[model samples]
Target: MKNVKKPIAEELDLFEKKFAENVRSRNPMLDRIMRFIIRRKGKQMRPMFVFLAAKISGTVTEATYRASSLIELLHTATLVHDDVVDDANLRRNFFSINALWKNKVAVLVGDYLLSKGLLLSLDNDDFRILKIVSTAVKEMSEGELLQMEKTRKLDIKEEVYFEIIRSKTASLLASACAAGAWSATGDEEKTRLFHSFGEKIGISFQIKDDLFDYGHDNIGKPTGIDIKEKKMTLPLIYTLQQADDSTKRRIIYIVKNHNKDKQKVNEVIELVKQSGGIAYAREKMLAYQQEAMALLHQFPESEARTAMEELVQYVTERRY
Candidate 1:
């Protein structure tokens, strides 16, 4: 991930400095929590998208910094809240904020982070950036709720599944790229192009994630966690589409009743693999990947464009 962003390493460093500065607080406890979050930050992929889009479209400006930070802040807040909602005890191999500080403190910290992001945009008069991010956040919330609502019934059509992933995962990446483009040039057309590009890449990224759940591939996380949670991912969804009524019922039965049983989970995983689910998902992911690359190719050639294409490839090839 670090190497993938080498084209914008200096800009990323500046982004990091600004991100830390923005999150600092007068309150000692809040400051401590903010510091901890900064220390435990993830890949900064969203910010990378922001910077790369800025460089690709136009000059990287101070507004670009704030835009990137805004994306990161909102992303961090969502992750914090997700940990609380998922009852997760760890994040990226470290203790989660909810685990260390309790749910109440974690929720407050999440709110604080969200407020910080909003204020950053407001203080800078980055209303376009604010609008992009706010919409993405709303879409993300809707995605989660929709996925949760469908979890029990387990009847997710292919189109609805795309909508859910686009909302839940791709929306933020779309916003990051669009916000960067807007901050750079305010060229609405270019912003729209990059926005669509980000959505395609984001969808491919998530499809790859779903693929990991059925494979023995070393993706760091255990396979079948989605099954255990009764979440219907792309592979399982596609598998269900092709199955007979009885087969679908049997699979659902396993998911609903025997999800905790390792053997049953393995059996289900095997069934999905045998049913061409993995192949269908790989085809869809590749299609999205190709679409994203096609969009990238439409832009004039540059190092930034190459890096962006590499990012798309990274999404498909990443093992973890």
Candidate 2:
């Protein structure tokens, strides 16, 4: 990440200050929550993607800063709401907003962040960027609902799984790249290209995350959390596809009924491992990484381009 941020360090610094200011509130309670969020912020990967995409396309303008902020705001809003939906108590190893402040406050905070993002774009007349991000948000919501529906039935196929991740996870990253390119170059073609690149990267990113679920190492999140939630990931999906009739039925029954049992979840993980699902998912992730690199190479050689390549590698190679 240090290598990835080298080309856009100053821009990122300024973005942090602006982003902090953008989320400030007059209400004391809201302000406190905002401060808490800012303090425990993640790697700011989305903002880095925005600035790098902008720099590779053209220059990082003031509009680019706003684009990054808008992306972050939308990302944060979704995370807050996701915790409520998932009943998750922890985020990035810290108590989640819903856990600390309760679901009602967390929901309102998510709404506030969403409204602030919309106002930031509308007030500045950033219609193009706004449209790109709004489309992502809509797709994300759809993707999430589709995943929930599929989870109950345990009927997700490879195509449906791709659709779910593309909408739920890839859409936001795609918008970050599109919004940044449009803000910097105002070129529809370049924006489209970056959006495609970001989508591939986002898919690879989610695949890497799914792989972590089968890992035994002490990583960020507990292994098999996805299995426990009955969320069909690529590895588990592939494993089921390759299983014999009785084996497939048994696995599906375990996932649908005994998901909360640690032993059952571990059994599913072992099945994924033995069936070469991990290796298959890894191959697909690398294919997407290569495709993303090919799209990024279209921008020509520059520090920004190199940094973007490093960012792609980081996404696939990160431990957590």
Candidate 3:
């Protein structure tokens, strides 16, 4: 299963070369920025999953390449716009496109990526895939709006937070898998099942990411940015829900009213840990991952299924 890594990279490289044909000529500036991003890519997880699924299911083809690359394009677009919306200065420990290139250029490039994704999906002559991807874009937007609507509000519950992550993160992941399965055979049921698996794993991934916000030297980004941004996440929500009145008030005041401090952030995490909030989140994440794994029951035991299982586990163990 892990052996999929090398083979997947080979395919991505070939596909990317074809995908970038004329990218330099027609859109020179955009191409340069995009090329830079392509050079620094961490993982084409969405595309890799689709390719592996196709391989396991039998025969990777143009359909798999089309669907998977569309996802990569959309994910990159989302990251570009997210940096602008969050006013983030850095990403992957580098200056954000929005910060360095200016938001206007960033916005246009993000829009370009989105347009490219749709145009490429349409080129496949599959209206169904286009519809699914379009719906995913809408889902991501609505989820982000919902999260923003809840920001700085200390009373946000765990259920609501889960709902938010599902919409914002899981929906796109599910859509990617669904598109991949559909590309393979258009077996609607199988597509739906992969979608289910992706949705579960995606939500778990985001929840784990939230957990990293309270820890030191967490992954690529700085810790406690959520607190500085005044956004309440699952762990903090859980702590406030279960903590004593004094501790609850103190946590709220430190995060919401006073300036953001690392010491207070640590104390807040301690409160969440002591109140079993961390344990509860860990359980929830595992349950979601298990649900994701269970969805593979419909498929046979094969290398691809094993690859998919490993993908879910990777998200579960993410440090950031």
Candidate 4:
């Protein structure tokens, strides 16, 4: 991440200042919450994508900063709402908004952030970038609902898994790149290309996350949490696909009925490892990474382009 941020160091510093100003509120309570969110901010990868994509397409401008802030605002809002829905206590190792402020306040905070994002774009007449991100928010909602629907049934096929991730995880990243490119260059063609590139990278990112569920990584989440939640990931799907009928039945029964049982969840994880599910997922992840790199290569080589390439590699290589 250090290497990826090197080229955009100055831009990122300026963005942070501007983004801080953008999210400020006159209400003391809201202002305090906003400060808390900023202090506990994650890697800022989405804003990084926005700036890097802008630099690759054209020079970074004021619009690029707005694009980054808008994306972050929307992303943060969704995360706040997500914690309420998941009943999660933490985010990025910090107490979640819901955990700290209760669901009612957290939900209101999310709505506040979302409205701020919309007003920021609409007030500036950033119609093009707004359209791109709004579409992603819609897709994300659909993807999440689709995953929940599939989880209840535990019948997620390989294609359905891809669709869910593409919509849920990939759409926002895709829009970040697209919004950045459009903000900088106003070139529809380049914006579309970057959007596709981001989607491929996002898909690979999620696959790597799924693989973590079967590993002993200190990624802050427990092994087989996905299984415990009855979420069917690519590895588990592929593992079940290759199993004998009896084996399939046994695994499905465990996942559907015994998901909360530690011994049963471990058994399912072991089955995934023994059945080469990890290897299969890793292969697919690399394939998507290659595709994203290919699209990225279409742009002329530069410091920003190199940083973007390294960022792509970092997505699959990161420890957590």
Candidate 5:
């Protein structure tokens, strides 16, 4: 953590200006949702990865910026669609697109981002970029479907859960790195390494976020939002696996009941603690973090390498 690279706040301003240019030609309605979400524009980690990766390869160029923006737009689209599916109201402490614009608009917003991503990919006529982006979209959607299929189902298995994370969350991260690598160097081997690295970082990212679900401290969003929504994330899944038959029964009952009662929440919290779910997920997260860093080592050393490693460390240690 000592080696953490301070984020350039100005980079986001660049992203916003570029994004405004990218979306200005679109219809007014699509433009509105795009602008609405972009205004908050949290940490641009995905695009940062694209930019940093390109920079490391000594290929920082227009393609890097365009690819980075495309990744951000694609990411925002996913968030808009996810809000509609999850019925979320609050995100980044603002009303979600679905909450403000309603469900239909949210869906269209996601579609426009997808279309915009495609158009951006064509800027270099790199079919390889298209393939990477399309595959990630498919994997992400399939992950969502899988998650929905198992929602509130107490018998969810670990293998199935890993598959869901890999598809839904990891895939886009992988695409972000892979597309960045392709957009710059077109080296499939190095691209594959970065792709794997991003996926590992992504899975670790989700595991940490899921661990925050039961966090008492202000890790990020409300600790029990997933629990309130009847979602069973990593800690809970690990708890279910390790808890004794009786504790297991109680866990299933509380989750199946979709309990928001203070006592029920505490019960799940205690079970997660006793079952070592938090520790286990932390271990898994660290393992993935190691894997991600190892992947970056293949490229020798550079400023981009430092930033990339710093990004992984940031993801591992972030409170939110």
Candidate 6:
């Protein structure tokens, strides 16, 4: 992340300022929550994508700052909402908004942040950015609902799994890149290209994240948490496809019936490992990473492009 931040330090600093200002409110509780979020924020990867994509397309502008803020605002809202939905008590090692403030207040804060994002676009007349982000939001909702529906049956087809991931994980990234390009040049074709670039890397990014569920990397959550939650990740999906009937039934039984039993969860993890699910997922993740790099190669060599490539590598290579 430090290396990725090097090239865009000045612009990123400005973006941070703008993001802070954009979220400021007079309400004391909301202000405290916003400050807490700022303090515990994860790597500002989405804003980095916005700036890097903007630099690749053209010069950065006020619009670029707003674009980055918009992404962060909406992303933060989702995280807040997700913590409520997951009944999670911690985020980035800090007490989650819901845990500290309770679900009712947390839910309202999330809604307020979402509304801020929408009004930001409207006030600026950034219709293109609005449209792109709105579509992403819609897709994300659909993806979450689809995943919830499939979780009960444990029957996520590969295609459906891909669709779910692309929507839930990739859509915001796609919009970020497209909004960045539009902010820079308003070139429709270039915006579309960057959007596609973001989508490829976003899919790769999500697959890499999915792979983490199979490993014991101390990544906030414990290993096999996904199984406990009955969340069907790509590796599990791929493994089940090649599994024998007996093997499949056993794995499903553990997931559906014994998820709370840690011993059973460990058994399921070993079965997935022996079945080569992790290897298959890694191959697919790398393929998408390479595909995204191919898109970056379409642009001429520049510091922004170089930084973007580094970001892509970081996405795959990150252990947490």
- Evaluated with lDDT, which candidate comes out highest? 4
Q: Please identify which of the two predictions, 3 or 6, would achieve the higher TM-score against the true structure.
A: 6
Clashing pairs in 2: none
Runs in model 1 with CA error above 4 Å? 1-3, 216-222
List TM-scores for all candidates, in order: 0.97, 0.97, 0.91, 0.98, 0.90, 0.97
Ten residues in sequence with the least summed lDDT for candidate 1: 214-223
Supply candidate 3's per-residue lDDT for 93.
80
Candidate 2 deviant stretches above 4 angstroms: 216-222
Tens digits of per-residue lDDT for model 6, 194-301? 999999899999988888888733454348979999999988998899999999999999999999999999898888888888889999999999998998889899
The number of clashing residue pairs in model 2 is 0
Model 1, position 49, has a per-residue lDDT of 94
Report the C-alpha displacement of residue 131, candidate 4, in angstroms: 0.4
Clashes of each: 0, 0, 0, 0, 0, 0
Which one wins by TM-score: 1 or 5? Answer: 1
> Which 10-residue window of candidate 6 scores lowest in summed lDDT?
213-222
Candidate 4 lDDT by residue in tens digits, 1-320? 89999999999999999889989999998999999999999999999999999999998999999999999999999999999999999999999999998999999999999999999999999999999999999999999999999998888999999999999999999999999999999999999999999999999999999989987345554478899989899999999999999999999999989999999999999999899998999999999999999999999999999999999989998887
Q: Across residues 11-37, which tens digit of lDDT does each residue of candidate 5 receive?
A: 545766888778654577767776787
| Reference-based lDDT, residue 54, model 2 | 96
Candidate 4 wrong stretches, greater than 4 Å: 216-222
> Candidate 3 at 174: error in angstroms?
0.9
Clash list (residue pairs), candidate 4: none
